[model samples]
Target: MIALKRLQILLPFVGIAVLLAVWSLTVWARIVDPVLLPSPVSTFRAMWIGMTSGKLGVDFLKTVERTIYSTAIAAIIAIPFGILLGSSEKVYRSVEFVIDFFRSTPASAMFPLFLVLFGVGDRTKISVAAFGAALVILFNVAYGVMNARKTRILAARVMGASRLRILWDVMLLESLPQTFVGLRNGVSLALVIVVVAEMFIGSTDGLGQSVFEAQQLFNMPDMYAAIFAAGALGYGLNLLFLTIERRFVHWSGK
Candidate 1:
């Protein structure tokens, strides 16, 4: 079992190595133009230079900040609203169409609307991300609450628990696993929207800005570097949520 666990840990690294090997071979064999597809070494070099020069660092931090802000805003708005809606079928039904409509709409499509409402500033970018993330979070959180065991709720009520107490102690805890799922999805969506916003909405610094600038200049290595940075950022954020879920939602599976 220990060996199996070790293999599981090493398998991802092995897969990554194999991918890198194939990528390197393609570049070495000139299957693709180096100008369009830089070698892994060149991309790594570019990333290192960007990091050392502090450009990537600054952009990375900006992207992280925007993601955090958007996610926080989404959570703040989603949790309570989701609970309220989930607690009452009437409330959920009343706004279900609206929620589904917005959720189905592409977040990028709403960028123009947000820009019109909030202007071409961080507000617009942040708001778009928050809006998209909130819907996803709300959907998951409400489902979590609605799926809470009826028997537990009945037990609580039979013990004379107040509505608020039942909500706070029972429903909230029951929903945490699904809420974390929402949070993980929400954060990913937030990052995607933020990067797209920075790319199109005139940002001074961000991973998206770096990528856009690099592409415009035909700096393939730099663009690849920024792309890798974005991927790493996404992986890191997901890992963080997974860690938090494991710690907090201890009873989730059982």
Candidate 2:
């Protein structure tokens, strides 16, 4: 298992290494202009300078903090509503129309309203991220609830379990994996959207702001570095989420 897992992890890195090598060769051959496509060395130098000067490090932390805070807030609010709606047929049916409507709305479209209502600030940025992320969680939680094993539920009822008891002991427990999946998706989306929202809203510092500044100054390498860092964060956090999910859901054991 350990060997297989190690191989699985290494495979992607190997592919990335090959791609980078090709990129380096292509740049060296002048197939891609340095200005159009920066060499890895140049990008790395820019990253190193940004980090050593504390620009990249600071913006990275700020972006991470905002994403974490907003995602957590969204999860806190979404879980309850999901539970309530999921536990009842009537509630689910009634709210499904509204939930579907909001969920279908693009998060970016809501940014203007958020800016007007909250003004350009951390609060508005975080709120937009939280609200956008919450919608995804809400739908997933509802999905988990609606799709829960009906046989298990029927058996519980036949065994004289009360609705509340069935919910706590069966419904919620059974739906945890799906719920976690929702939270994971929400966290990822929150990270992406929050950064975009922060770039224009009122953020003083963040990876998004770094990207914006880089564009304004025509610092392509710096912009690429920040973008690369964002990709790394997303990939890293996704792996972290899988680890946590595996720990909690032992049925998913290797």
Candidate 3:
């Protein structure tokens, strides 16, 4: 298991290294124009320059702030409602309808309305992302709660466990693994949404803005750097979540 886990972690880095090597070789060979496909070295240099100037840091922080805020809001709003609706069959049946509808709705389609309402700021971006991301989280958490072991629940009831005790000790604990999975997915969606939101609404700064601006100026190296940063940030976020899951949902490993 440890060997498999190590391989799982190493494979991605190996793949990335191979890709970068191939990219550099191709660029050096002039198989692709530098303007079109920057060399890995060039991209890395651009990234270093951006970092040294603190542009990348600022943009990275802005995106992180937005993502964190949006995710927090989504989780707060989704979790309680998910628990409430999931606890009862009737509530689940009714709310499932709403969940399906909203989950199917494209966030990009609602961007215009958000811009109009919030005037093209962080709130609009965060709200739109949260709205879309929360549905997946809500449904997953609800399913987790609903599908918690019936035997355990029955045992708890027979043992005269209070409702709160059952919720805290059984339901939440039982549902945590599923909830974390949902959160992982939600964070992925949120990252995508955030980039799109920054692009559409034109934030003061972010990876999206950096990419957009670089493209306009035809700076392929810088554009690639921005994209690299975004990819690295997204990867880091997933890593952080996986670590949390491994720590808190250790029982699920069994």
- Could you give the C-alpha RMSD of every candidate to the true structure, in order shown? 1.6, 2.7, 2.9
Ranking by lDDT: 1, 3, 2
The worst-scoring run of ten residues by lDDT in candidate 1 lies at 49-58
**Prediction-by-prediction clash tally:** 0, 0, 0
Q: Candidate 2 lDDT (Cα, whole model)?
A: 0.86
Could you tell which candidate, 1 or 3, scores higher by lDDT? 1
TM for candidate 3 is 0.92
- Candidate 1 on 1-254: residue-level lDDT in tens? 99898789787699889999999999999999888999999999999999779598789889999999999999999999999998887889899999999999999999888988999899999999999999999999998998999999999999999999999999999999999999999999999999999999988899999999999999999999999999999999999999999998999889
The TM-score values for the models, in the order shown, are: 0.95, 0.91, 0.92
The TM-score measured for candidate 2 stands at: 0.91
lDDT of each: 0.94, 0.86, 0.86
Which pairs, if any, clash in model 3? Answer: none
Model 2 has how many clashing residue pairs? 0
Output the number of the lDDT-best candidate. Answer: 1
